[model samples]
Target: MIGARLREWARRHSDKGRYTPVGIIFHWVMAALVILQLALGWYTTRMYAGGDRLTAYQWHSDLGLLILFLAFLRFAWRMMVPGPINDADKGGWQTNIAYATHVVFYLCFFGLPITGWMMWSALGDGRPLYVAGLVPWPQMPFGGLDPQWQWAILDWAEDLHQMFILILIILIPLHVGAALKHHWWDRDDVLEGMLPDVKDADDHREGLTHKPKRPRSPRVTGAG
Candidate 1:
């Protein structure tokens, strides 16, 4: 009986096309972290210098690593349980564009932190990264280059890191705008699907004590 009830519950949820609870949690957590990291990155670069700059860099590095770890976990979860089916009524071009956008986001999520790590490693300044000023974080292996090449490699990595940041700066706003467009303009559940702790009217109706009435079938008439 328990197994049958669980199967029925799964069927009902799958039919509604909503994301699984794990997916919703991961999505929102990562979204908040990414936003925080971006704000920290922009503020630290613009406001701090000298020792203050180094301290800010430590925070930025710590947050970047955290994001990197979460990004991998989120990717794994996504692979384990696929997202909802795409809207069949939407045009092929729009669907393809959405897929491409997601691909770019995943690439950035992985790429930005890695380049930042490389930049720090290439510097070889011997300053340790302490997570929340507690545990010492491990440095990447690129720290031991010859003095002649160290600065050159640091410069390259720094450039790449900044480039990825710039890409994110552009892409994130566009992504948010598109989600808002779906929610407000198109009046769809695209945005709500990824959020937690809120259910749509249909979901509420599904949970009601009374059964819903079924619509009547139209009477068929033979053509003369």
Candidate 2:
């Protein structure tokens, strides 16, 4: 009786919070940008040092600006919303890892782009990075840091950005694998909570609400 009542309460207050397309857009768009940036980073680092490409520097400057704008909005949105927490997760180790990785991911996404902006601003060229005659971008290692010191700092920022992302790639799979484990093995709703496509079409169609006989604590156990 006690357990059942607890569950009903849990259902009443489940963190199945609705998400804005901002969240949706931020998540995927950042993913796309990061992948593109990785490729661009490689191309520019080589091309700048002398490889072959028409205006590699120009492209890098422009893209860095794009990253800066997107990341700024993403972070602001994250602050406004209390994100959904999946119920299926239930372990300290896993939970901790997820939290840490997410924090790091945000840092990398923001830090890299911002630094690039600083670099460009510091150059004092005042020329905006653009492509095909549209879309303006800012630079990083922004002017005023002094050439000798600025060069070293830029190198550090570049190296740090790459290292964090490499770790990020590893974390991505661990996160997905854990969610899937809960779905198939535990037969839980962790995966259901995140599906843009309804995995629980039945429950959804039944009116998006379940009146559990009992309620559980609003406590969440895993990554959201």
Candidate 3:
């Protein structure tokens, strides 16, 4: 019964070419965090080996774990509530490619973090890992292996992490460009669907257009 109600609520918003508020929040919050994570990762790699570098790495890891957790929740929510069928959803090769891009994005979202976690675990330095510096996160069971095996796992995970990072670096701009195309060239609500509902002056003016204007008051000529 509860599931049906939730579906109905989400459907109402989707039918109007908009995502539910929850969906919008998830999309934007994750986007900001992912962008920050990318920048931080790049900056951290350039830092010299020292205490600061270690601290930067910890921040990077924490952000990764948070992103991983949020991605899981976002995926579950997406499964439960279908996205809106905007103008962008029209049948074509572009639409197909867009869907494929989203699949790749989700893969990166999960893949990058898991590989990073593995890399941390394989280091075998007994350093603690935490998710967003709050919840304690467990490492993969890599301590039982031989030193050579641990090194092998570390190298493997690092390679996978780099691969996922490269993929994301390439995809981010393309995704933004596509969204801009949908919004500007296509003049559709596809991009707007994910944006927050804000009543700006333009929207207020547009709303007034549909309402009856008040009659002007009769002017008195006695003063003249």
Candidate 4:
């Protein structure tokens, strides 16, 4: 019953060509965390090996775990309440590609944190782990393993972590470009759906020379 109520609540917003507030919060919060993590990761790479570097790394790991936790919640939310169908949902190869891109993003959302956890565990430094420096987290069961195997795990996790990061580096630009194109060049509500308390250009001109008229009916009508 709760799930049904939640879905109905989400559907009301989705029908208006917007994401539910819960979904929007999850999206932007995770997005902010991800950008912060990327910047922190870059900063840590340049810092000399010392206490400060270790502190940075500790914070990074804490954030990664926080991301992992939020990702789980977000994924569950997604499963319970599907995303809105905006202009970008037009059925075509482009739409298919967009769907694939989302799948990869969810993979990265899960992959980065898991691999980072593995790497930290493999290091066997015996440092305590936490989620956002609050929730106590356990390391992977690597402490009992032999040194050679621990090294192997460390090497494997490091490679995977870098691979995920590289993939994100490539995808983020394209994603931003696509959103901007939908918003500006195409003059669509695709970007507005993810934005909070923001209506499409047609609803509020903001600063445009002339106000665009809103459509009375759905533009595309198929089960989203």
Tens digits of lDDT, candidate 3, 56-156: 99999999999999999999999999999888789899999889989999998899999999999999986889999999999789988999999999999
Sort the predicted structures by lDDT, highest score first. Answer: 4, 3, 1, 2
Query: Which 10-residue window of candidate 4 scores lowest in summed lDDT?
Result: 206-215
Who is ahead in lDDT, 1 or 3?
A: 3
The lDDT, on a scale of 0 to 1, for candidate 2 is 0.62
The positional error of residue 119 in candidate 2, measured at the CA in angstroms, is: 4.4
Each prediction's TM-score against the native? 0.79, 0.66, 0.88, 0.89
Best by lDDT: 4
Expressed as tens digits, the lDDT of each residue in 1-224 for candidate 1 is 86566545544544555677777787778778888988898898897468888788889988888878878988976665556663422768766777788888888889988888777877888777654456677777656678768888778888887888788888888888888877666666577566553544554564442223344465677756
Question: Please, what are the lDDT tens digits per residue for candidate 2 over residues 1-224?
Answer: 86566444444334564234446567767777777877787777776454355367667656766766777777876764545565534568877776777787788777776666555555566666652236754354346667777777667766766676677678777877877876666655555554443334445444354322233355776868
User: All candidates' lDDT scores?
Assistant: 0.73, 0.62, 0.88, 0.89
Winner of 2 and 4 under TM-score: 4
State each model's C-alpha RMSD to the native. Answer: 7.5, 10.2, 8.8, 7.3
Model 4 residue pairs with clashes:
none
1 against 4, candidate with superior TM-score: 4
Error at 123, model 1, angstroms: 1.0
Off by over 4 Å in 3: 199-224
